[model samples]
Target chain A: MDVSFLFGQFLGGLTTAMFLFLIASGLSLVFGVMRVLNFAHGSFYMIGAYLAWQAMQWLEPTLHRFWLAALVAALGVALLGAVIERVLLRHLYGREELYQLLFTYALVLILGDAAKAIWGTQQLSVSRPPLLAGGLDILGTTLPTYNLFIMLIGPAIAVAAWLLLTRSNAGRLVRAAALDREMLGALGANVGAIYTGMFVVSSFLAGLAGALVTPIQSIVPGMDVEIIVEAFIVVVIGGLGSFWGTFWGSVIYGQVLSFGILVFPSFSIFSVFALMAVILIVRPWGLFGRPIR
Target chain B: MSRCRILAAACLAACLAPFAAGAESTIKIGFPMPLSGPAAVYGAPVTKGAEMAVQEINAHGGVLGHKLELLERDSKASADEAVRLARELIIKDNVDFLVGTLTSAEAPAVSTIAKENRIVFIAPTSKSVQLTSPKNLHPYLFRLASNTDIEGHSAASIIAGWKEVKRVAIIAPDYAYGRDAVAAFIGYLKKARPDIQIVDQQWPKLGQSDFTPFITAQMGTHPDAIFCDVYGGDFVTFAKQAGPLGYFKAVNNRLVDGGEVGTTDEAQALGADYPYGIWSDAYDPVIWAGDEPPEHKAFIEHLKAFTHEKYGSGWAIMGYSAIVALTDAIKKANSTDSDKVSKSLLGLTFDTPVGKRTFNAKTHETEMGEFWGQMVKGEHYPFAIISNPKYLAVGPFTD
Candidate 1:
């Protein structure tokens, strides 16, 4: 009700939005260009968190240890995405969309079980880097320095991703392939390479989100499935393939979830879905998605 | 044709042999538990405990001159799956007794099946009071864990002693277990400390990843203390997120968590991140500061060997006690009949690794107590351990 309390709530919403955007952007991009709803995106995110936890174990404790571990995890998951794209996803691209969906779903299950096998079922946690381990007082309310880092990084990643898609050659090629793969192929741009490259970038975003979330959330089994549901909600409400749509959707969702509990304590769980339903009723193709052909 | 007929006859004999031999030599106890997923953190250890009990009993010439055979099945923490498995174990496997189920959701459903089939069922871990509420209570079903009311009352007693605390905030998962426990806590707290004001209550969904909003909002109320029911990985997430925000410092470290966060599994998982001064409860503690009983010491040693881990889990005692109790009931009844076993289990006292526990004849509930203490950095172990724990017996509150 007061300025400080409202501001604190706003910051919390923004922090939630950042995490949602990080995971949803990759999912949206993959669907935009690849036309494949990668069900395994959350699995990639979970793997990233586990990999970072593993990296931290191997590395010496230092101020930059968390950052280094996150980078390692992101790269590791990106490489895994590339391999999966090449070995399995590539073969199913020309088939029915159902096949691709099933393939990705299968990947989710396999990766989930594989993570269990490797990490065991114990929940794992990661400490924030010493530089960002404390808090800062703003508007008479305390906000975690780590959360502030996420809020800043979320926008930076968004700008970087936008620039890659609009200003760079690879970006143009990917956009072209998303519009018409045959035309891009005829123009002598290796369509397969562009697809694989897009998948890797999308995977990197997911992995990064996963690694960053380790300091905030418990890295546990079934985290993959838990996150995928929220990520899917973000993407669907934002407009399936639109980058800015995903961004705004996450922003809306994060705020609603943060404030919903305060306003309607008993119905907070349904608030997100209720907003999604209203959006779908108003904008059937999402806020920014194109109408089906 | 003759050779084919001979092979078919041999296969039939092989299939029927176990059933024929099992009926006379073994008492089958069907155990359905969450062996995978998030709940597996507790479930896997619980199963190991049951296995250890069966092994020890069998080694000691079995119970009632019959080997106790455990038919363990993974319920995956699903209520429907647990019910289906319970039925399958009863009808298909012909298990004479039913035991196991981790979550509050799964236990009640399986209890219904036990009632329908007239088989004695003992729940080891599920603490929902609904499982044995007068409406749901049956002759066949028995609960080994302390129910929500007892847990809540115990928590309130702990909080009431804090003279400085007046305004309190509650945060728990928004479900039956959380709702019931918090309600019970409030009911008791009001009776104990009428001056205490309930400032705020936040019902986050179970397994909620983010607690920042709830934490901030609750802090806005400026309560002197908080009663938290979040447990396991969720608690780990909550503590890590809440720490940097000065949430603990804001409340002056007066968070009394009733979700058994004092257990070694959670303490070890959180490591140094665990809030040291907060009060919590656990069913068992591996490290006993006072003179450790030989029975407990031997149990811990056997558990370490059985689990193949350096440290024994406090959770393992639940399953171990259940099996031991079931076998003891069988020995008392002198038969595997459900009627005899169920009747024998009423008011039955059994020895556990912790201490002797008895099932209440009227309620079909065990008077199980828990160790309440403050979490502090351990001297020997890297994780936190309970400091100067006081055992809160369920008898006073349950009665």
Candidate 2:
């Protein structure tokens, strides 16, 4: 009820929103350009987390750099995404969207099992970098420094993505491809290369989100399912391929979930679905999503 | 015979091998557990425990002149899958006994099928008090783990001993297990220390990756102690987020959590960040360090060698106990008939790695024990170990 309490809740919501945005944005970007809903995006995120944990084990002693490990993990997932897109996803582009969905869904199962086989069935965590291990006092509330760092990452990524999509020649090609892939191909835009790039970037975002969250949340095998569900919720609410839509959708979702718990502790889990149902009823395409081409 | 006919006959023979083996007077127990997924942390060890027990029983010339056979199935931690697997095990596999449904829901779902089909069901690590409550009790259903009441009271009894503690905050997942655990703890805590006031109650949704809201909300109330039931990955998240937020550092505030938070897995998950001095409870504690019965020692050692680890998971002990209870019940009845085994299991005594346990005939619930101790940095163990473990018996409060 008080200012401090409200401020605390807002911060919590914002922190949650940041991670949601990072994951959903990648999903939305891939869906926009490729028109393929990657169910394995969450698995990519999970793989990212596991990769970071493994990297930390090797690097922490020698490099002592959490940031470097996170970067390496994200890039590693990008490479994996590139390989998947080249070998599997590229071959199925002209097929029915259902085939694409099933393919990615299979990846979720395979990758999840792979992670289990590699990491074993135990929750693992990475420590917060020494510089950001504690909290910062703001308006008499102790906000975790790591949370603030995560919160800042969302906007930084948003800005970077905006620049990449709008300001660069590569961005133009990607957008052109998203708008009309057949035309882009006819115009000699090398659409295949653009698709591969988009997938890599998308996977990098998912992986970055996973690596960033390692210090805050326990990394576990089934975590992919938990996060992917929420990411889908964000993607659905934001509109399938709209960039800005994802940003606002994540904000709405995060705030609703955080504040909803305080008001309706027993029903907070349902609030997201309720909101989704309402949104679907009014706007089936989502808030920022364009009608299917 | 023609070449095609020869190949077909060989394929037919390979397909029927398991059925032929089953016909050879073996008692089959269907073991359904979450061998994968998030719950696998608990389920995997539990499966190991059941397998260990089966091996030991078989080594000892088997039960009732029948070689014990374990047919393992992955429940995937879904209640529907557990029920489906139970049906397959019962109708298709023709298993005589059902063992190891890990979660609170999976246990009852499979138990209902077992009850209706008149097959003996043994739950290894189900902690929900409702499973063995009078309303849910049936002739076919039996559990060999400490129910929520036992753990809650055990936790409460220890909290009551802290004379300096006054106000307590409760944080648990918003589910049957969590709500029931908090309720049982409060019921017993109120009885033990009437003066203590519950200031805040925070129920986060299960698998919630972030606990900042709950932690911050609970911290605002400024209770002297916090009682948390968040376990596994969620517990690790809560500890990591709350540890740096000064939730455990405030003056005169202590933290006590259920057993899952104190396991070697949790400790290993958190590493140096694992908070010390917090009182924690476990289903299996490291209490047999100096002197343990040879059977208990052997069980622990074999499980460690089998699991290839030093720390013995409580779920492993519970899993072992479940089979031990089932085999002992069958021995007592001198028959594998469901009715006879069920009747014999009532008030049946069995020796487990934990200690001697008795199944109450009325509740169909066994009086197993849990160990309570403080988490401290151990020289001999990884992460933190539960120090000064004292065994607490199940029953009394929930009954």
Instruction: Tell me, by DockQ, which candidate is best.
Output: 1
lDDT, candidate 2, A1-293, per-residue tens: 68887888888788888888988889999998899999999999999999999999887364358889899999999999999999999999999999999999999999999999999898899988888987889987888888888888898888899998999999999999988899989988799999999999999999988998899899988999899899888888988889988998999998888777777665657777889999999998999988874
**DockQ, candidate 1, vs. native dimer:** 0.71
Worst 10 residues of 2 chain A by lDDT: A57-66
Clashing pairs in 1: none
Candidate 1: TM-score?
0.96
Which regions of candidate 2 deviate over 4 angstroms? A291-293, B1-16, B251-253, B287-295, B394-399
Clashing pairs in 2: B259-B281
Give the per-residue lDDT of model 1 (tens digit) for A1-293: 79999899888888888888999999999999989999999999999999999999999998899999999999999999999999989999889999988989999889988998999878888877889988899999998999999899888988998999999988888899999999889988899999999999999988999999998888998888888999988988889999988998889888989898898877557888998899889987787788878
Q: What are the runs in model 1 whose C-alpha is more than 4 Å off?
A: B1-24, B394-399
Give the top-scoring candidate (lDDT). 1
> Ten-residue segment with the worst summed lDDT in candidate 1 chain B?
B390-399
lDDT tens digits by residue: candidate 1, B228-339: 9999889999999899888999988899998989988888888888888898998888777556678989999999998888888889999999999998998899889999
